[model samples]
Target: MEKMGYQKNWNLDKIFLGGSKSNQFLDYIKRLEVLGRDLERCVKSYTTSLATNEAANLRKLVEYIGEIRVNLSQANSFITCLHSQNTKDQDAATLRGKVAQIESNFEKKLSKVKIILANTKQDVWESLIETKELEDYRFVLNEWRENTDKHFSDEEKNLISDLMADGYHAWGHFYNALVSSINVNVQVDGKEKNLSVGQAINLRSHPNEEVRKESHNALESIGEEKEELFAKILNHIAGFRLQVYKKSGVKSVLEAPLKDNRMKEETLNAMWSVISKYKKPFSNYLNRKAEMMGDSSMKAYNFWAPVTNSNQKIEYDEAAILITEHFSQFGTELEGFVKQAFHEAWIEAEDRANKSAVPFCAAFPLTGESRVFMTFGGTFLNVLTLVHELGHAFHNYAMKSVNGVNKRYPMSVAETASTFSEMIIFDAAMQKAKSKEDKLIILDEKLKCSVMNFMNIHSRFLFEQRFYEERKEGIVSSARLTQLMRDAIHEAYDESLEQPSTYSWVWTPHYYITQSPFYNFPYTFGYFFALGIFAKAKEKGNEFEKDYLNLLRDSGSMTVEDLVMKHLGEDITSEEFWEKGMEICVKDAEEFLKLTSLDDIE
Candidate 1:
């Protein structure tokens, strides 16, 4: 495969002329204000009647609202890219705040339209859904109708949406700021240095046992010192959600997330049931890993420890080449898209101080572009990160021609392309490994992802489930939160660890996000979902590539179950479908153990 030149930083100029202060950005904001006013007028003028002209006007209004949303997303994505590159950029922070307010205003206005649609006569609404102009948006229109019962009155809905900006969302901001500012003192090489919570956690993967132990202790200390505050944050967030749920007459807490994910409760239940049955294999992998590390039992900190000491670091250029070469096997389009991403400077992989610690791919629908952010440290893990994010970029590319509204996929299905990409690269790497030790290293990396998705994320789901259940009774204290976390971890891991971290909930930022409740399980969902897709790809080879692209393109237009059924001809709501994915993990675990044994003998 021919190598493509990679850009060190993303080209944000393609979105707007300036970062946050540019006249172009200012002009975009002004346009948003005008659009917001027009949308408000459109909604205010809407009536319950279903006249042909009114239906036509309604379609136009919906399209206009979608346009505004796309522009807003573009603005938000730009500012976020700026903020992520330089966390200390106060200008970016101010712009983000302004954008949030603009979005809130848009939401309040959009609620009126929602009320109009929700209250429309069933026959009229069905007629509108069947209209030629609105045929592409039938799913979104149907979703609006279904959500009619869950909504408050127009006035009440607007009030809740407005209040959520400064009320519910503020708590999440507070938690983010507090956690981001937290610095732990760790002694590295007989000198004490201050490290961010994320940096400290990275040490857990260090080759030295002492470093991992020290980093773990440092994290535990911070959790101990701030548990009460963290607990308050979680409690208040959950309490607010519960209060809203009760006021809105929502039957169950899970209903909101399941609806948001466009997934059914039975599907979630089926997936978890299959996952629960397969825990032993992951536990066995962990035990074997611990034994390889010369430990009596695996500590929580040892989960990410590397099995080999190769210290081989592939440069960014080499990593891109490797990813492109492997992706080429799937199809020309995928390979070309990845090459374009690298050549066009769509990725920001430079490591620098004050950059966001997390890796993410931000898609700008209005511009039909995506930007990837990550600190590449020239490790195998970094290569995986590159490909993983490229998976997201590929998905976005696949749907670039679709309307923005139809491109909005649920988080549950969002990971399908990315995890499938990882599977491709990992399989290729395993095949190309020259020795048992090398293959063991690749297997270990693969299993690490599996353990994270299956075990770590599963524990988070269990904890949140119990937390919400108990939050209905009253406030949960910090100590009690710790106990809940430990209990959940024990249950998920089957009590395999000698000591489970009680403060696990304290460090995770997922619990703090107001918009995304139960954000953890989607990772597990996406992983296994992708696994099943990967299995199909393996069986059908090149024939599956077209279906995979189609699946990615349609992700935003239909429910996950429907998408799977249309593409793979499988029922996602059954344990049988998820069990196929679990069987892959079991096979990987078995292969990992065998390879580790062979490496030991060699």
Candidate 2:
């Protein structure tokens, strides 16, 4: 039996088999959906009726809806997990689709409620919140009120929502397919290797310089061939986004992401400002690395190449123990969850055909259970992968105690706990480094990752900004988009790279993502955010843990600033708050310098 606490193999049958096919399950679902619809209607009717402050009625409606929503989402959690685990599973896929359609139908019906609520007097909303029975939903009601200004006429809002299925979303799918299907021919040891997009990218991290450069060339070559289509997709998506942003009265498309991030412009500016200062240190790190590799200058392709040496391959069991021991510092709850995750086969770690390429965790919210997906082939990165996914699992654990209504954290904060976990475990690993070469290898890994979050992610953010700005003018040509992307990259990495080694072509896939523009900033944000928060924990000692957990607990309930203030007493909108994180970045450079002694290595 696997020793991890949670089982890796999920019981999809719990959701859809046995009693699932029976009338009881079907009846329960139908009745729940009906109740949901009814509750929504009640809220709308009461609000629109203007019948003598029906605060009690509103409370009853919210409570009923909350109960039904929890049950419905419990069922949804199972279906979602099964669908992801086996997208080809016909029955599961059908169930998932049906659930989604029902949910959308519910959303459409609820739009009426939103419109009604929007028309409600501010005094009425305040009275409802002050009512004993309705107080539970105060947060939800307050948030809705905040969004009232963004609410368009029901007709336009509904039309836009429905239109996305055919328009903007389709562009995103096309872009993904184009990138995923791109074939690259890489030369290795005098042999030509045909690679998928992912394989080619992974090869950029190869120890062999020739392999990395060849892979980079192959990737860029394939991207060049598809540039026109990629540009068209980017332009169409951006145009669609701009139209919607204008319609919604958002100043820019970035406003939504930033608002959604619960952060302000100053926070981002401060983070990048600090990152900008470290460009010199990064340049030094790269230079030192190049000298160690006996190269005059390093190309973009050689960025992920291994430095110095790594330890002997660790067994999965050994890695689990190491991670468990490291995570124990957080508390027994986190440790036990990590242990359960490994023991119960909650992790699909085996390398198998027809499996996902990246590591991720999916939570079964109903049971507060989670499954981790990854292909672990015993590399150190594989261990880190486990740690990262387990970080997500830990987040799920923290959220489990929250109402399902308040557990869905935004994507920007979604990475916070996971990245925080990575730092904790990595620090432990770094401390145990046994030799100078091992220390170099460890520091190199840290520095490379830091560079990616700061420099690479910054480049993507800049390109996306330009893409959105220009895309408003209509479709950008492939060549024009490429040039804009190059300019964005050069601007972000101004002093980070030495002459003649820049690879501006890397913005290809990132710019092509459809659903979220500026998908890149979240990474850098998560990194610096966690670091800043981590620094607070170090200063305040054990007392900070409660505040931190409370902040996490409120992630679903409050604005990002509110959460930060509750936990770390810092305003996310302030430049100083972000610069604190940046200062840590500088300290990181100093540590790298102190530990590695680049002079000797060079």
Candidate 3:
């Protein structure tokens, strides 16, 4: 990548003091926090004095609330960014406490406001957006309105929100504890090595079949022993959410997630319907993967096995160049962002002490700066990950202009820009392939990924849906949950797997991820959606690039369907929309097979 002059003069401490003494900064923050409380208190206090449609008072309240909110959030952004980038930094940690204090105090003040809104005239509150300048707050306002209907009382809502710090959220931490503590004893280099779920599952992608099998079996055995506890947790969390959903007048537990996604339930169902019809194509890809791995009886554990020989290494500098070259095709703006990311020292590139295991991107809008956290070890996957995360930085860069409201897109669209960036890098790589062998490896890896994203992920989602449904009636027994899982795997994999049962226990984590219920489908949706969008680009040729970037830019402002319709001239709800995307993947799978020829050898 070309140097964009970010490294010449940059210091993190200039923005944040980085020590406990940053408490001095808290005076300004605390003042703002108190101002926020005053604003909330004022709004709630005057709730009885004015009618919902009282344009003047309502406008004043909304504007004041918006101002307090922006100040509180800006302070929040600074503190959160520092803590996330360097958790051990004392200033950041101190600021985190300050931010928590602000939220706690603000919540107490806001509780009355919430109650007032809940008990108010519904139509009048809904119409407040038009009367006020807070049009960007429609989603949050709607959510607040929904909360009012389900609210027990101001005291009750406060208690529930407080207890949730230790109740629902605590359950999530407990689940994480269980996952972290699980020690699967797998045979590595003829020695028994104890591994965590993250480590063990990764072995399924190992080049060695023996390592993969042992890792898979050991991983399953560990989860099998704890299945009952896992089932209970799943049961408890599902029951909790269903109760909340019912009280809120929401028809389905999925209602909240759908709302959170900012799309209709019908759209999600439509996307999956298209996905289900294309399962055969996914199965065919899996079968090809099995043949490539020389497995007569493939199971879920074998799903991530390397189907092509591409242990290719890349230098960090070269990786940056590839990223810039690929992204530059989109336009100069993205190229500039990519260059800035690499040169500005926005990325923590090499694995080092005090760094976390996973990769993430954090943006600081106060300075139009973004920090990428990843340890680049020069592997192809690492390079791809760099591109993936840089994609996130690029996203926040585009979104910086939309402050406060309308800036936060739903989780569904959050992946759009990143996935779109991945497609760009992959397509560029494919185009520049110097040999058929290289091309085959790239093609096979890409399709193998597509199959896993679409099929394997869908199976996990299928199981979660069943588990939640069953849990609604009562607690699902470990044995019952296991059986349900096997059924889901059977349905999703169908005839693709020679033995799907062996890997049934692999999805235990999904059953227990309390913080993110039904986390499986979003990944599959993101992957295929990007494929659909990329396919459109192919059809439009040169005219597609501007529209693609424009769609990404507007992801924060619009619904998923609106973005799709605006760019692709198609609605995601239609079967044809998904079929087109799946067909493209099928064609890629065919190319992967023809080039690999491992099926012929088999």
Candidate topping TM-score: 1
What's the CA RMSD for each of the models? 2.1, 4.1, 4.5
The residue-by-residue lDDT of candidate 2 on 1-602, one tens digit each, is: 24543333445454445422434446656776786677656655553523336777765655565556566676665654554454344565455445655655666655665556667777766666687765656777666556654447767766776666556665764554445445567887689877656556656566577888788777677667766666666677778888888877787767877766656777677767767766777677776677667776656677777775332566777777788888777666677888777666667665443332335787776666777776555556667778878888878878877765567566677777877887877677778989776776767767776777877788778777876777777777778767766676566666445432223433345554555567677778777668866777667755666666766777777666666777777877766777676666666666767766634652
lDDT of 1 by residue, 85-133 (tens): 8777778878777778889999887666666777777777777778888
How many angstroms is residue 84 displaced in model 3 relative to the true structure, after the best TM-score fit? 8.0
Candidate order by TM-score, highest to lowest?
1, 2, 3
Question: Which 10-residue span in candidate 1 carries the lowest summed lDDT?
Answer: 46-55
Least accurate 10 contiguous residues by lDDT in model 2 = 498-507
Q: Which regions in candidate 3 have their CA more than 4 angstroms from the true location?
A: 1-36, 48-128, 131-151, 177-200, 225-233, 315-317, 348-358, 363-365, 374-378, 498-516, 536-550, 597-602
- List clashing residue pairs in candidate 1: none
Name the weakest run of 10 consecutive residues (lDDT summed) in model 3.
3-12
What is candidate 3's CA lDDT for residue 254? Answer: 77
Error of 1 at 255 (Å): 0.6
Candidate 2 deviant stretches above 4 angstroms: 1-44, 49-52, 63-97, 134-136, 149-151, 173-196, 309-315, 498-516, 539-547, 594-602
lDDT of 3 by residue, 549-584 (tens): 667667766778887787777888777777777787
